[model samples]
Target chain A: MTTESVRVAVAQTVPEFGAVDRNRRRTLEIVRKNADADLVVLPELATTGYVFESESELADLAEPRDGETASAWAEAAAETGTWIVGGVAERAGASYYNSALVVSPDGLEGVYRKVHPWNEEKRWFAAGSDLPVFETPFGRLGVQICNDQWFPEATITQARAGADLIAVPTNWVPNPDGDGRPGDWTAGVHQAVAHADANRVWIACADRAGTERGTAFEGQSVVVAPDGVPAAGPAPADGEHVLAVDCDLARARDKSLTPRDDALADRRPEVYDLG
Target chain B: MTTESVRVAVAQTVPEFGAVDRNRRRTLEIVRKNADADLVVLPELATTGYVFESESELADLAEPRDGETASAWAEAAAETGTWIVGGVAERAGASYYNSALVVSPDGLEGVYRKVHPWNEEKRWFAAGSDLPVFETPFGRLGVQICNDQWFPEATITQARAGADLIAVPTNWVPNPDGDGRPGDWTAGVHQAVAHADANRVWIACADRAGTERGTAFEGQSVVVAPDGVPAAGPAPADGEHVLAVDCDLARARDKSLTPRDDALADRRPEVYDLG
Candidate 1:
């Protein structure tokens, strides 16, 4: 199962609301600490945080597409010779986008905007049309942020597009209907595992920690194998945590779940209705 | 959450291979034992068993749509005032279909032919075209068999078709990559949870137990809540077990995962490339 071995790090850290400078420093410090890891992932909106008081406040704190946030991360990645993926609230021309910025030792390489905005984010951010897969130093990476993880189509599409791993930068809130059980009906963890197994792709979700504007975040940051089991930390429910796991990206290539079943090949898409 | 509360029974039992008469009797016994239950569900091909040695053997054991299997289950349901749903090897005209038979006190209410046949079954059965939703006394019921549950789109489409509960009669095989983690990777339990939570629908999978022809059946039968958590037994890895849970079918109606996020309403289907 070991092929193209890579060490991945998930930084589940808290971001101060509307504090761009502080959050940028926090993000840089977290990424620098994991310099030995081949790939480092940070939580959603790591540059500005979540839960805006107003659209104006979000705009005030948002960075430009090629802004200070990207430069800082690129510099850090270059210094560490690592590939970094993190979420940011980006100002794209006249509109704003909840984006996942990709940084490699070479430079800031790609940006993937959130396809499906969650809740009030729809009121602020423009939904992205082009979902790009990045051929990185570590592996082929697909980007998703927060609510986009809820859609199986997003993950399925990424897998078809040849992404070995889907990196989710998430600001997860506590599920109101949690039955004290962790998997389903609570958070997107099980969905991550489900999609990973079904699509034969590794899934690493870096979720935010602590309370922001009265909303508590679920910080069960996880790195799941293609086999649909956790290879790394489900972190802590609410805290700053660092988790690193050695992953063989090759295992994600074979969609064959068993001797008989090939995930995508076995799909009866012709009979399926996408409603 | 309580709108229409109904007691549903899942009988996780093994069917002797090539013994249709004995297996039919066994199914009747299980259903009669749970006579008090509002809805009773059994495993895939409960009357004929799984893993047929030959196409001729499968045809020999197959029952007509209105034959012994349906009549026995219908009689049991009528005598007990219960609605029964279970898998059967059906002889539809000259072609065979891996079907889920729905029996009420009235008689055979509906038959949902297994659309996506697993491996060898593809050689023996004709794939179904229409995936129908039944308006039952218990709730709006959607039926699927073993391998069909692997596809998220099938379940999501069922939810969209106005089914409160998706009843899956499955003969689950042990996952090739299972490290005994007991969730998504192992059984479809977490995938069931994931899809159910994403669509706000209750899912009940009644999987078989015991080994047949060197293939081990995973007997983790479960009834999951609309919130994507199990409400009943994953029975055991291998055993004869009966699980019953009183579920509020209405919670499945409110797709509101949070005050802000409505599962179906939030879907960006336009951007989804199911290809």
Candidate 2:
């Protein structure tokens, strides 16, 4: 099988908390400059802020799936003709979901609800039920929200579902007690790399920055290969940044090696109850 | 307050393929001879050997929770008056569990089934439904089997459950391709160290060795401190070995610097439904 290489970009920026218009504008500016890429990703909850203190706060921040934020993202995708995946809050009737939306030149391709809600998020959003993978211009792409990266099963399931490239949009918080060191919040990145290596898939993780409600955002967006070898940014300090890399989707698929031979193929789901 | 240091012996040995009787005999001999240690640990699947062919093979090797294996282990514990934790095939009804039995001078204290089975194990064993932490003469200890160590949740849960020390019994296979090269696998050791640092607990991981059914076991048995520093062996070779270290439980409990807090406390489990 032949492989194809596509140029991918990760937009790393610091979005003001709850300042949707400002964040959206800043994101578009970055996306516009990186139009040469096939795919681009942004941070989790980039449309809204990370801290949702009350039900009123969450409800106020929530927007429809086809709301203004997604429409703006779709417009950028159409203009750039590049696939985009990023964090957004979705409003469906009386409920709200922490979700990542994927957009292409054609339109809003799909939306993946963040399956794992971290800490305060549990009080705000309901859990997502399905795992979705989409076929993109570059290859098969999978989307996972911020905290979802911590679970091996999330990434593993995506890989098994035939995603050559997995993209994560995260609002990763830097370890405040890490003696103010820049590279201290690397555990998440390392976990992403291990997931890529274990599944033989390329992973692109884009994170937002700036301190939101005293929690400092770590913006070390990174891209890793099928061998779990890091290929791009642990990007420089906050502000607006773009990390571009040539991702070989075909090569990832061709070099696909499940560490353990077809472990998923032999799963006896009936006998075991995960709940 | 004066802190006391206890002699902990981590038995990092390589068991012969499918040699349950021999391995048990060696374990008993080691326990009888090593009178200095307050606690001892053996590798995962130390009894039946790792990489068994079929469910029937695992079943054949499986012993009742209170059967021969437990009796022998309990005898060693009673004779040495040392707390022992080791892996064995646990048979209950028609189901088989790759379990770790914690045997002390008093008797069999607790059992933990391997939570996340790797590779071929999915075919022979069922995933554990519950996580259990037990109290021992030495300290409050948490037990996990093999791949469970890879996930932060397993260790974090134990810490939350008030475990002072975490013991992992693993039959870890070295990367066949990683002959002399060093990279992520070495850095991956930080995962355990991070756990120790974050939770202020001592972590002792004993892994098996030797090529069994074409799988090469990498015997990197290690003991890490509450500071996330190495206290003992990432042993040099894949052979019969013993790594001894002095673990101060009180010191771990006293450390003020921790990796858990609001920003760090950010974990979203509701979104991780795929697993």
Candidate 3:
């Protein structure tokens, strides 16, 4: 099952902390400008800030899967005739899940709640138990949010579930004492590249930029090919901008140089107690 | 025992393919400049390129651990009054092993052969079964080369054997078709970061860069803090470079963030039969 080539864009910018309306408007504007793209991505918690000071604040910003924010994105997708992948605080039952929503021309296609929460995220969001991937005009796309990117199992699961492209939306906070050095973000990008190389799948990562609530955002948003080479994004320190690139999905499925399945084919999971 | 803080520089650079003299000269220059650094690093097979189409070429580059090239680095370490860590093809018995050598201010401190031959490396180098770490002024440092970076068992073994910092010397090849975009090297860095984060230890990675023998190098030589944030080198298209950073060995021994030597503390090695 080969896939066709598609153009993807990663919108790297800083959203106002807890300013949902402003964030949505800016996102829509960026989406409109890149209407020609097959897929457009935005950062995790793009509507809400990474720092959730209180449950009350989370409740205020939390939205149902079919809420206004989702509807707005759905409408934007239909208008642009493109697929949109972005992060939002999802209100599921009595709890909230850090989720990534995939909106298509038809409407909301899927929502992937972050499987692993990092540090403070545990204080607010519940962990997701299920993993899912979906078919799109571009390819079989899998969506994951921030913390989920850190785990190898997360991306591997998506690949096992038949995902061709893995899109991660992240509101990554820059190291407070990193002294503005580029190395501070090595772990984050490492996961993305490893998954792409190991799974032989394309990865599109959109990261938030600029300072919000005393946290500086390191704007190294990026897109990687199956062999783990950066295809797009990962802009410089001051680059809080949009990056677009055309990617051939078939190229990612090349199994000669990097046998995607072979990397995980022999995994003996019975002994790995990664707690 | 309490450990003292020591500044170690993991020099990540791209060695010219089969350019032994030039690569060795560059290594000496970096060692000289980073004289104040307790330890300086170089990538795997620094004297030879990663992709050797024929066995003759591999054998031609293969040298004894006490050969001229290794001796040169040893002399440099003594002259600069610092330790040097790097990768090389070693001649052992009737076979060859991809090895990492730790040259100290006194002389060759220790040598570790690659435990797990990765991909093409299997065709060239024999695997070494033993795992060990050495004592240094900063702390106990463990050495591993390339593919060894992917396995948690290897790292956990080093930690169990008493290592404060795990230094990986790698000649990582970039995707042949990657167009030099950011975030292209996700897998390599991901393995390093996860190892550091999960182990709650520091990881000093020295990676090779530049296009040698038609293979491209992604120069994201990184230093992962005990907290898992990476202090990385400049993403150069191709060339020689050094990524130096100050590492606090004492902080790595802190039990608050990383409680060591428990069931949860050590990774079980019996389960992974896939590699």
Tens digits of per-residue lDDT, candidate 1, B1-275, equal 12489888888988888888998898899889988888889999998889987889987999888998889999999999888899899998899999989999899998999977888887788889877899887679999887787778788778878899988999988767666353433547777778887888988889889998888898989898987777986678778898999989988888886577788877777777776
Docking quality category of candidate 2 according to DockQ thresholds: incorrect
User: Cα deviation in Å at residue A207, candidate 2?
Assistant: 1.3
- Candidate 3 lDDT at B91 equals 84
* Residues B52-126 of candidate 2: C-alpha lDDT, one tens digit per residue: 887777877889888787899889888887888999989989888899998988888888888778777878887
RMSD of each: 2.4, 6.5, 6.3
What TM-score should be assigned to candidate 1?
Answer: 0.94
For model 3, report DockQ.
0.17
Highest DockQ against the true fold, candidate: 1
Better of 2 and 3 by TM-score: 3
- Mind giving the per-residue lDDT tens digits that candidate 2 earns over A173-213? 65333331114435566566556665678899998877888
For residues A21-59, write the lDDT of model 3, one tens digit per residue: 999888899999999888999999887767788988999
lDDT values, one for every candidate = 0.84, 0.74, 0.74
- Deviation of model 3 at A82, angstroms: 3.0
lDDT, candidate 1, A1-275, per-residue tens: 12478888989989888888998899899888888888889999988888887789887988886799899999999999888899999997779989989989888898989988887887788889877899986679998987887788898888888899888999988666767343432367878878887788999999998898898898989998997788986877878998898888988888875476688777777777775
